[model samples]
Target: MIEKINLNNILFLDIETVPEYKNYRGLDLETQQLWEQKTQYQRKDEVSAEDFYERAGIWAEFGKIITISVGYFINKADIRNFRVTSFWGEEKKILQDFTNLLNTHFNGAQHILCGHNAKEFDIPFIARRMIINEIALPDKLNLFGKKPWEVPHLDTLELWKFGDYKHFTSLKLLTKVLGIPSPKDDIDGSEVAHVYYVENDIDRIITYCEKDVIAVAQIFLKLRREDLLIEDEIIHV
Candidate 1:
């Protein structure tokens, strides 16, 4: 079935996010209380809300997307290439630019958005951030009333699950087992917030995000029993 889908019609994406505020003190008193209440179970009396605040970026309400990297395949006359690009800077601008990409090129029924564990994370995170920024949801991210089958999203993580809903796999681990190049050679998701706040190197994060996008594309190729992308075939645009 994977071979039946058109690679050109699919847009592969990955996003890097950080906590909305640098620290717990950055939040207003009322919002701080809300954060404590919201994460009570996750903290489980083991760590204070302030101590756990570094991970707040995992939640849509408490986080902002810093960068979104996307890659798509282009084949012309049997010459194959993949182009990758990123939208970075302010959160609102990032969301707006990514929204524009979706609305412009991949808005058709035949177009699909692919990501690793995106059905559970990336897809909804983008939608929530868009709404927070007062941007209209694009057709690809707007999944309000559509039936399950009507959604035009594809998840490489889900595909690897193979109906084992109880199973979970991290992108890094999946890539390792599948022999795809690792995307986390520099920093993992846990360090994204720190890199953005303390190190102040967003360019590093953008490179990491793009690598994840390329890894996803490569994983799809492997799943389809096709050749993986060569270094020369990946273009950073």
Candidate 2:
């Protein structure tokens, strides 16, 4: 199926997320109580809710996207250049900008959204955030009444599994196992919330997110049995 699809038809993406507030103390009293209650089972007396707050980004309700970096391939003089752009900072702006990109460029049956584990995490997170921000779901992201084949999304991890539903793979691990370049050279997902909230370095997060997007694109190419694109082949948008 990947072999039949046009390389340029895929819009590859990655997202960086953080807790809605800087720290657990930043949450309001009622919301803090709710967060505590929601995480009780998972915390299991092993950690306090405040300690577990670092992982709030995994939940759409308690977190917000910090950056969404997306890339697409285009041929220029027989050289394929992967162009990337980012929508970042405020969640509303990020969603709005991403929405505009989908509506303007990738809103078609021929276009697809692809990422590592995106179908399970990134895509769903984006959809939930869109609803929370009151933005209309872009056609590609909306799955209402659509059959499985009709879903315009591809997950690299899922493709690698080839129907092995019991296995779980992380992007970092998959990239290493497949001999792809590491996207986590600077910082991994675990440090994102701290980097954003305490260090106040959003540019770092954007860079990390962009690398992940590029890695996703590369992994997709590898899955299609295509040669990898080099650094010179990347064009920043």
TM-score winner = 1
Each candidate's lDDT (Cα)? Answer: 0.94, 0.91
Model 2 TM: 0.96
Clash pairs (backbone) in predicted model 2 = none
lDDT of 2 by residue, 23-128 (tens): 7999999999999999999996779999999899999999999999999999756778899989997899999999999999999879999998899889999999
Candidate number achieving the greatest lDDT relative to the actual structure = 1
Candidate 1 C-alpha lDDT tens digits along 1-237: 889998999999999999999998999998889999999999967799999899999999999999999999998888999999999999999898888998899899899999999999998999998888999999888888999999999999999999999899999999999999899999999999999999999999999999999999999999999999999999999
Model 1 sits at a Cα RMSD from the real structure of 0.8
lDDT of 2: 0.91
